[model samples]
Target: MGNTINRRSFLGLAGVGGAIFASGLSGWATAETKPGVANDDFFFVQLSDSHWGFEGPPNPDARGTLQKAVAAVNGLESQPDFIMFTGDLTHTTDDPAERRKRLSEFKKIVADLKVKNTHFMPGEHDAALDYGKAFQEFFGETHYTFDHKGVHFIVLDNVSDPAGSIGDAQLAWLAADLAEQPADARIVVFTHRPLFDLYPQWDWATRDGAKAVALLMPHAHVTVFYGHIHQENHHMTGHIAHHSAKSLIFPLPAPGSQPKRTPLPWDSAYPYRGLGFREVEAQRQETQYKIVELPVRKV
Candidate 1:
């Protein structure tokens, strides 16, 4: 199917952020048809930091925000090829039973999505307390890889380790995985923490993410999608691109924008502000991606 997004569908989705087109693996570029290998173009939905059991002043409708997001995705004019929740499916809980309960609740809520080919990863809130023991019981592996169309996707587990490191074992595995791919292969990576040190004082940077970047640097076409900071951020490591998704529960302050990293206060006048998900359109043939951020609710 053609991957062009129609105006009606775009308007109906209620985008809150401007669309970003990443091309040439270095900076933005206009969308143009390039003759090359025949590859299918596809798009996927990215939802993150739901914090399912979270309750407090940061958000008054935390209970309903996630459900609203699911409904929004379901109501899309065209269903995505797949949906990926980058992490923090549930809020942190000290009690193991409560953690399991939150995870179970989150699973039930998202099951209502019209598209069933959904993927998931864990955030520190859901895994750090138990080293992903509870999360693994719900979701499968903490890290794995798969291919769609002509693109190879790598989901790394950085939060499973309390110190926020991808660990030596996963790094070696990543090297092996990259070695199997051609230098010009289209690659996408998903992780909870930023692969580069965005802000170490606030725990936003992964401990050993530099090693993972080194493994990916040699590849010509690589893009990363990650979430944990509860905001949308785009960065580049040499020719590779990294994009962060917004949170579903609440928005956090910008990286090192304040004395401490905390959730921006709930805005009564504008409900669900700074909270939403994103849809990523990937043109495998051209090695280009377009990102559109959608609101949790129509204003």
Candidate 2:
């Protein structure tokens, strides 16, 4: 039997103020299976681009948004197995002291989460200025790999170089990591920027992302989740799937939709319009994952 998810109850708890989208994953199985062993299903939450210290016309409630998201996640009827913040936990600041301060405050806010099994990465805003030194001090390694029930999770650092490149060294590390896994392993990658050249004119592409994709091409079941574009996007790199998450601070216009990649204007009537997080429920036996887009605040 497959694991059952109470979608309606989850959306109700998450305050489903926006549209909900779903996708499927095939050939996903547990890491180790023994006779009579059952494959259990689990879920995790992905929250990105909170921009904790941002203050601008794009979002009047900048200071309060991240808090609202934390409260919403805490309110979930079924707490996620883990939580992941793809990147941009704080806004960009050139001042070293202020940057660390913002990171500290962001950390403090999220500590309220009901679920403590959380993972983090960095966005250019939090890392580029100092090549991720401060972020590393706060969040540990920028790139790493961890195994869940049956899935291999890889967190790649593309923003730390300032040049927006993963660099050859990390690519080699990624290659070595993949080589140790079976060719048909169920792999998921988390990164701050899109691994493909979504739109290079606006600095949305990773410098050597193609190389990273090439190294991942041999894996049969691979998915990439990322944030930075500030909107939901889905794309395919051959057999691999890449999904981008929305921002908690504000949303940007669709790729190449405008001359500049600026945040969409704040709509006073519809506060938190384009800002939200997601819940990903992995049904291992069924070989699919359901993603629910949730609002920052309940209506």
Candidate 3:
């Protein structure tokens, strides 16, 4: 079941888009916030598909729009301890200087971010152009794991293959990495593309996503956070929940539902107002997390 909560009122392009609050069963927006990081408390930010290179249309000014999102996130009342950007950090093309310029501009824009920790993973646009060689140089390891608040966070690199699948080596590492996790411990996975067969025609789903999902089935509490869809949506298989983030760029049409899978025409009357991030909160031990989508807008 799903519910539409508060339309948090995000900035829309020239008053086109309005805030939308739709959620799944995990809907619980808390008024009381836990102070600091506790034994059973912690939250992180998820921002994806910034698309720094693209220009015009949906967003008349992509760079300006992104800057606005930066401001909105930096000014959060309860600032997240860290943030993760899922993918599509840059536009297409494999120019080394262009790549450096896009990344440098992105970093420069974020230099003013107040958050203490910020993590980044490459997407097809960033990785595919150079086979992720430059991506690794700029952003470091594509696949790695971390333990936070007793929760396991596995960031995978699924953008390498044109088919959008995790190669055998990464898959093997993931299985071994997750083999010993206890049922009670929370396991959260992050990637640029989705892990499900969302829409193969448009390259929305991960080809080898089932393998990853199978490995994750043993864990009681598992949430997979993904980007690249450029919009908010969710799907579930067994106990695991899969979520995709909204892009700082333009919104794409829903998967499979689209006739041609092209960038649907943005409602010109309501321009693009964006800069959104996802918030995942873990309450008491073993309690499912409270995930919230926070969209950034000009004040």
Candidate 4:
């Protein structure tokens, strides 16, 4: 489904402790949208790398930044059909109890979102903790498939291995899942790391992503959304368009822009710099779908 609504405004988080919208959403056109209207046009927000429980100079109040993101979503003029957090829900820890605590806190914060249908995927940070045991307990089924509004959505777990590989089981599952869908179905994939070799030197590429990409190549309309590098990036694999969303906590340098892969320092003067979500305006047609990436706004 596609919408013509001009929800193109940016949200600036005032400070670290309290999340306030520096700029509000304007230029919205009212529609006859009801509580549960089955329309052909709808949109969703992609929020990633909130990094709750993170404490450091890069972002002191990681928890509050996530809260601000929630507030920004709630403050939308019209609620999105759904919201999906691409991963790194929390900063990782080796301690079992501490991992649970961080996930628990993240769940509590996201519970405030007005959007009822929210999806989550795991990044290396969460999946590396206990080899995804702890993450699965908190968020069920790291990799799965679902259908919504004539589109086939697949969530892949590519971070369970430190080297970033989606194992054989998941690959077989992906093959089976794709086999079920029609050849022309509009497919959307969500994951944590870049499915392509964007920058292998920094652990940015998914080791087995080529296999998955090959599986998806048969599909005519495919779009992949993921986050791990903590920046907005776009790439093309055959006909698939892969987009990476910005982090809620802090932004990282562009692919190979910096000598080292480190979180860019936050500027106190320009707060919320490079921290926000990706707004996707998707439109669905009979046999195909289209996606347009709106500007990455600070929220």
Residue pairs of candidate 2 with colliding backbone atoms: none
- The local distance difference test score of model 3 is 0.69
Best prediction by lDDT: 2
Q: Give per-residue CA lDDT, model 1, range 179-285, as digits (tens).
A: 99877777889999999999999999999999999999998778898999988888889988888888888788999899998889976766777877776776533
Clash count of each predicted structure: 0, 0, 2, 4
lDDT of 2 at 163: 90
- TM accuracy, model 1: 0.88
**Which ten contiguous residues of candidate 3 have the minimum total lDDT?**
1-10
Off by over 4 Å in 1: 1-38, 284-299
Error of 3 at 133 (Å): 1.2
Better of 3 and 4 by TM-score: 4
Lowest summed lDDT window (length 10), candidate 4: 20-29
Alpha-carbon local distance difference test for all models: 0.80, 0.82, 0.69, 0.74
Q: Tell me model 4's lDDT, rounded to 2 decimals.
A: 0.74
CA lDDT of 233 in candidate 2?
92
- Candidate 3, residues 156-270, lDDT tens digits: the string is 9999666677999999999888877655556778988888888878888788888988988887667788889877787898877888888877877888775776664655444
The CA lDDT at 20 in model 3 is: 29
Once model 3 is optimally superposed onto the true structure by TM-score, how far is the C-alpha of residue 44 displaced, in angstroms? 1.4
Model 3 ranges off by over 4 Å: 1-38, 273-275, 285-299
Candidate 2, RMSD to the unseen true structure: 3.8
